[model samples]
Structures are given as structure tokens and as C-alpha cells.
Target chain A: MTSPPAVRLTALTRRFGEVEAVRGLDLTVDRGEIVAFLGPNGAGKTTTLDCVLGLSQPTSGAVEVLGLPPREAVARGLVAAVMQTGGLLKDLTVGETVRYVGSLFGHADRSSAVLEEAGIADLAGRRVGLCSGGEQQRLRFAIALLSDPALLLLDEPTTGMDVEGRRAFWAAIRRDAARGRTILFATHYLEEADQHADRIVLISHGRVVADGTGAEVRALAGGRSVRATVPGLDETLLGRLRALPTVDRVEARGEQVHVHAGDSDLVARHLLTATDAHDVEITSRNLEDAFLSLTQEAR
Target chain B: MSTPTHPADAYDPAGRTPPRWGGFNRTLLGLELRRMLRNRRTIVFTILLPAGLFLSFGSTGQASDRVGSGNVAAYIMVSMGLYGAALTAAASGAMVAMERSLGWSRQLRLTPLHPAAYVVTKTLVALAIGAIAIVAVNVTGLLQGRPDMPAGTWVACAAVTLVSTLTFAALGVFAGYLVPGENVMQILGPGLALLSFLGGVFIPLDVGSTIWHIAVLTPMYGVAEVARAPLTHELPWYAVVNAVGWLLAFVAGAAWQMSRDTARV
Candidate 1:
């Protein structure tokens, strides 16, 4: 039989006095699936992650991981997390921090392999306070691996990393995912989610507004836009194009008309034959535009 | 969607599933112990401060002065020993406040380390620091003209001093919860010193005096009186009740604050 999903959140709602941080959030992740939660800041992404990690109790709802409560999974070494920052001992050296966490999880002897995997073996003697932000995040990744956990949760793990450092960090995470570890990360960076996550869940206003693959999420905001140079553009012809089944929206700028076409072929044929239209140009919105369009629509 | 009802509730942090972690992690214990010792401030408070007080107050012409049944040196030694032990223990325990403020405690919560184990480890490490202070003062007393006493008196005084340090260890945690990271130790240091003086840990007070009456109500009064029992050879009834009372009070206060803080996260 297949194993239970790595995580399940059912109608999760969290309210802090007057503010509802998360409202009716439902999500599920099968084992070994690499999922990324994408949202703008204050979109309830952190609140959702906090609920999943059992760090904060929901005002009304539940979060389960690996067929157990978040706390129980956490206690069984089945769950591990690498938070953005501020959860590590500043006074302890890299090696000391890693070793201390290992001992806490009954893995008192896992420093060398995990440290190498996290790419921090050389900085073992450096105190966490002395390490750069990127270096500290790498050390945190090493500590997260001490449990040999089946699932890993990262919250904006590369908030301070430069381009090259972020590439290396994700490379390490990719290797872990290759080993069949279920991975979930929350990030506001659109490119990171598009490139790294297999499945993207876009949250806004404490709710999932879009859930799909990167291509699908892009498709939600993009379609073929046909700009046609139609001579003698009259009100009657423009009205005809606007009502066509293939044309989602139509706009006219002087004699040139722009039509957002769900099917460019149909709109092109209509414009060419049904009217004295010619010189049609087609373009598609990039992911950047799609992201803006989708997020703006949610608001 | 319903919640997962797994059997792993056995690990519910209340000692229900103690076997998983064996109720303690030795590696963590060793690391905490080593880190506490490496701190220069801990060494100063646990060793230098107490030893200095012992030399300055327990020696000189007063060594022959009698209080109750023992000489002045024995009385002052027990009092100074109690101060050092309590200082070391409480100071160590209060470090948790800084850790929490730094978010280190939140990080640990994500691990399989039992929550109760965190408290146990802090208390254990505090006791370890308190032990060093207790030993250092006793040795200072032995070398620096302490009251000559029977073997049982020395052993009992040491035992009381060691055990009574728990009160301060718990009190430190309570204080830690109430204060911020930068001021937890700073505030507790001067506060505990004042409490020591008022509670008669620094000097003997007449039985029926107003200050002594007020002293009996302070936390130090109870533990100090108990530690000095072997030296004075009189275990006052009020002293025993006070020791147990403050121990329970501090423990309850710390546990309550810790639960609230952790939950708030």
C-alpha cells in the first residue's frame, strides 16, 4: 500500500485576536513530492508553515505530517525544518551546533556526513555569530539533516544569499530530494518557486488562490495577444471581434487593434477574412508578467 | 479532512514514552556542561566571588566569636557557601532566557529532544556550576582558617549547601522568564545579593528582631538557615517550611512562565 501523505492540512484557520493570519487553508503533500508555497509577504505563507511545523497551534483546524500530529512527527525524527534565521545558538561553533542538535535527536554521531552534505565542513570551527548569513543558513541545513528526516521544511532559507550561494544551496536541496525525501519550502521569490518547485501553491489573503505546476500557473495569467493593423477600423468590426468566442478581450488604439486571443488562429482568421485586417503580430506574457497579473487579480 | 490519530502520542512530552530518548541525552548533557564551564563570567561568580567573600568575612578576630554553638568562622562559611552555590545555580539556569530571546530554544523545539529534558538539562548544568562553587568555598574555608569542626558537621553543611542550591536554580528560571536577555543576569545578580544580606545569609540576626522577622520571609532566609543548620546545630522549624515553600513557589512560577512563552510561539 502507498504510504500516507507527508502532510495534510484540512481547513486550517488561524486567528490572532483581530487579525486572521490564515483562513481555511487546506493542503496535502504526498511522500517524496517537492512542493513550494509561493506568496507575497503577509499573505499567510509563514502562518501556514508555522502551523505545519507545530510551532503554533491553529485557532481552529489541524495539521498532520506522515500520518501523525506535527508534534509527534517532530518527536519521531520524521520531520525536520530549516527556518529562515534566528534559531541557532550564536555562541556555538558550527561543529558544536551541528553536534548538539545531532545529540538531541539521538544521532550523536552524524556531524561529518551531514556537514559535508550541507557544504560547511570547512567552517566547522567558526562560531555562528561569526559566520555570514549564507554560511549560517548552510549550517542550519546541516543541522536539519541530523534527523535523517523523511521530510524537510524550509522557510525562506536563502533570504540573505547572493546568486551563486543560492544556486549552491538549492543544489544541495535538490540532491536531498533526489534521495526520496519529501520537501516543502516557502518563498516570496517568484523565480525560485518557478525553477525549483515541482508543484506550486500560490497563497493570497490567507487562502490558496492558485495551485498548479509552474507552466499551469503561468497559463492562468497568459494567453496569445494578437495585435492587428486593420485599415479603416470601424466601431461595427471592433464590436464583432469583441464578441467572438476565441477573443477574451479586445482593445483599439487608433487604426491598430489589439486582441487577447484564447486561440490566436481563430482570431487571426476572423480579423483577416471578416474584416480588412492585415499584419497581425502575436506575443505571450512571460512568467514575470503572469506572476504580477495573478497576484494583482487576487487582491 | 480529519487529523492524524497515530500511535505516536506515546511521545507526548509528559514522560509517557521515556524509552525513546532514555529520559536524557548524555551528549547534550556533556555539551551543556562544557559550555557552562567555558564561560568566564560563570567562573568568576561561582569561584572568585564566593571565595573572596569567605576570606573577607569568615576570617580575622571573629573566627573565635561564637554564634549559637559554633564559632564565627563556621557560621560565616556556611553563609558564604550558600551564597556562592545559589549564585552559580541561578546564574546558569537564567541563561535560558537569553537562549529563548535568541531563538535557540525555538530551534530545539523542532527536534526530537523532549521539552521536559530541556528543563532537566538546565537544572542539571546549574547544579554542576553550583557544585564547583560549593567545593571552592569549602576548600577556601579549609585552607583559610575555617572553624575546626567534627567530620559530620563538615559533611552535613556541604550536603545542605549543595541541595539548597536547587531553590536558586529554579528561581533563576523564574527570573529569566520575567526579564529580557541582556538584563536577566545583571538584575538577578544585584537582586540576589540584596536578598542575601536581608535574609541573614551574610550576618546573624537576633531571633526576635524586626529585620530578622522580615528576613525569614525572603527566599534566601530559608535555604541559608537550612545550610547553616549543621554549623548552628539547630534546625529551626520555620527554616524547613520556608525552604520547601520557596522551592515549590519558584518551580511553579518557572514552569508556568515557560509554558506560556513556548505556547506563544
Candidate 2:
């Protein structure tokens, strides 16, 4: 039989006072896959990550990392994480911090190697306090690599990085992923989710609204909301337009009829030639718009 | 070119090999102690400050003045040593609070360091610094204070002061987890001073006075009384009970706070 997924959460629920931070989250991360956990603010992304790392206990249900409990997996150095903020000692130099964490996993000399791998070799002597936000993140990444962890979790790891720094960070991550390590990164950056992730899991209101390949999720949030000035708008006309394979929804508003279509090109052509539609405008959906629509659709 | 050998391959993939399993993590403990020693504040509090207190109080006491069988000068030195050692040990342990606020402790929680191991290591390291303070004060007394005391009395007082560090270290760890920010030590400094005074370490309260009755109940009182017992040669049964009682309380508090802090993580 095949082993269980690298990470699993079954009906996981967590509450903070009156707020339900994570509600019945069921997720599985397989080995050797780069998955992006995407969500807007307070969408339970961090909460779920916290549970997977055993930093927070689930209020109900179960969570397992690498076929073991999160704590157990961590103890074996099978799981490692680079959190968004504040898990470092400001007093220690980058090399010292890396050395200290490496030692915790019984890998004393691995720190320098990992620092080089994470592209922070020049920052060895710089104290963590003196490092810039991006530099500190790189240090965190270096420390994460010291464990030779099988499953890596990056929670908004690129939050404070500049455009160039983010690119470099993802490059290092891709290099690691090429070696058959599992990676699950939480990000609000739609471009990163689209470009770097093999699969995208979109969350809204503490529940996953979409989970599929980047292209597939993009399709869920696909469809242009096109509006135009059309004379003699009626239910028969709306029904006819909706009947088109490219159009999912068509509605009449005053003198104008709005059409939501999978392929606006087909809808636009049909509208202009078959019906008296004017002032036709088509706007392509950016990833941001697609993300927002997907989240809103779930609500 | 040969492929690089991964570190995980050094251990069994199942991670049950005794050689690779993380028990107490000695490297982590070594780094923690190394950093603590390099910290200037610990140096001042555990070494320099206590010696200064010893020279100031221990050298000036009248040689003729006596408490029980020991000279008043030796008494003053012992008391100052207790005050310094306890404070330093407690402060050393509570330094974790500042690191916690900076998110270092939470970072540690993600590591393989066991909770029990964390507690034991912290307590021991705190005591180590406390030992430095106790030794510094006693050596000052030996060289500069009135030398009329017996060597046995000297050793006993030093022993008591050194052992009492465990109590303060546990208390420090409790304080570290209880308080939220960098101000834990700043607040604890004054708090410890007040407890020291109330426990009759700085000034002896009259034996029959109401303050003396209440002093014995204070946390510091037991530690002070037990440390001075070697000088007085009048080790009271109640004093041992009091010290044990407070130590138990501090230890329980430290462990409870530790578990509560990490239970969610």
C-alpha cells in the first residue's frame, strides 16, 4: 500500500474566543509537490499552518504530518518551517542563529552549507538585528534548510522581500523542490501561486473554496462581466444569449444587457451580429480579479 | 561528479536509530550557555555587583560584633552573597522572557527540544550563573572581611547560598513565561529586592516582632534563614520546611507556565 500523504488535516477546527479561525479544514499535501495555500486576510491560512506545525492545537478533529503527529514529525526533523515574522534572536549573528538551530537537529556543520544554499552566505557575520527585513527572511530560510526536512512550510515567506529578492527566494525554493522535497507555502501573491505552485488551494472564510491546478482554479474564477447598450432587452433575448455555449449568465438592466461569458470573444461576436448590441467593452481578468471573484463566489 | 550525500541519510529513515534521535540536544544547550556567559548584564549582576556589595558591607562591620558563634562581618557577607546569588540566578532564568517576546522561544518550540529538557537546562544554567555570584561574594569576604570565622562555617554558608540558586532559577523561569516583554527583569529587580527585605535578609527583624512572624512566611525568608544557618550553626527545622515549600511552589509554577505556553503550539 502507498504511504499516507506528507501532511493531512481531517475536519480540523480551531476557535479563538468567539471567532472561528479555522472551520473544518480538510487538506492533504503529497510528497514531492509544490502547493500554494492562498487566501486573503484572516482566511485561516496561518491558523491551518500553525496546526500543521504543532504550534497550535486543533479544537477538534485530527492533523498528521508525514504520517505522524506534527510534533513527532518535527522531533524527527521531517518537518520545518519559515514563518512570516519574529522567530529569531536579534542578539545572534546570522551564522550563529543558523548554527544554533542546526545543532538542535544535531547538524552542527550543515548551517554554513544551508546559508550558502539560501543565498545568505555573505550575511554570516551580520547580527540578526542589523539585517534588513529581506535579509532576516533569508536567514530564516537558511535555518529551515539545516534540518534536511522532508516537508517544508513557508508561511508568507516573501512578505517583506523586494521584487528581486522574492524572485531569488523562489529560485532557491524551486531548486529544493527539484530534489523531491514537498513544499507548501502560504501566500497572498497571486502571481507566485500561479507561477510556482503545482496546485493552488484557495481559501475563504476558513474553508477551502477551490483546490486544483493553477489553470483549473483560474477557470473557476474565469468569465468576463461584459455590459453593453442593447435596444429591446427582454427575457427571450436574455435566454437566447444565455443559451450560447460561451455565456454562463446574461441579465437585462434598464436598457443595457450584461453578459458573463467564459469566452467573451464568442459572446461579443454573437451579440454584435445576431442582436442590436452597441458600446460593447471587454476587459481581461487579471489573477487578482480572478482570485477575488473565486473567494466572493464561495461566500 | 559524485552526488552529495544528504544528511537525513546518515540516520535511519524511520528516525528510530539511537545515534540520530534528539534527546536533550547538547549542542543547543551549549550554545544557550555560551550566549548567556557573553551577556554583559549577567556578568555585572552575577559577578561584579555582588563583590561590590561584599566589600561595602563585609569590610566595615565591627570585628567584636557577633551573631551566634559567627562574627557580624561574616554574617553580613553571607547575607549579601545570598541576595546577589538569588537575584542573579532568578534574573538569568527570567531572561527567557525577553527572548520569548522577541519570538525566539516560540521558534524553539518548533524544534525537537523536549519541554522537560528545556526546563531542566534553563534551571541548571541559571544556577550556574548564580554559582558565580555566590563564589565572587564569598571570595571577597575571605580576602577582605574579618577573618575570625572557622573554615567549616565559611564552606557551609557558601554551600547553602549555592544550593538555594535552584529555587531562584525555577522562580526566574516562571517569571519569564508569566511576563510578556523585555521589562521582565526590570520589574523583577525591584520585586526581588522587596522580597529580600521582607524575608529579613538585609536587616534582621526582631525575633518576637510581628514582622518576624510574617517574614518566615515570605519566599525569600526561607532561603535567607537556611543560608545563614551555617554561620549561626542553628539550622532550624522550620527553615528547611520553608525552603522546600517555596522551592516546590517555584518549580510547579515554572513547569505549569511552560506547558501552558507550548500546549497550543
Which model scores highest in DockQ? 2
lDDT of 2 at A148: 78
lDDT of all predictions = 0.83, 0.81
Tell me the tens digit of each residue's lDDT in model 2 across B33-98: 877788888788877877886677666637548787788878878888888888888887787666
Worst 10 residues of 2 chain B by lDDT: B1-10
Which TM-score values does chain B get in all models? 0.89, 0.86
Docking class of 1: acceptable
Model 2 Cα lDDT, one tens digit per residue, A105-156: 6544697799888888999988889999999998888888877788899998
Query: What interface-residue Cα RMSD does candidate 1 give after superposition?
Result: 6.7
In order of appearance, the predictions have TM-scores of: 0.93, 0.90
lDDT of 1 by residue, A15-118 (tens): 98899989998999976678989988898988888888899899987798877888887777778888887988877889999888888766448899999988
lDDT of 1 by residue, B35-90 (tens): 88888888999999999998998767778777666678878887888899999888
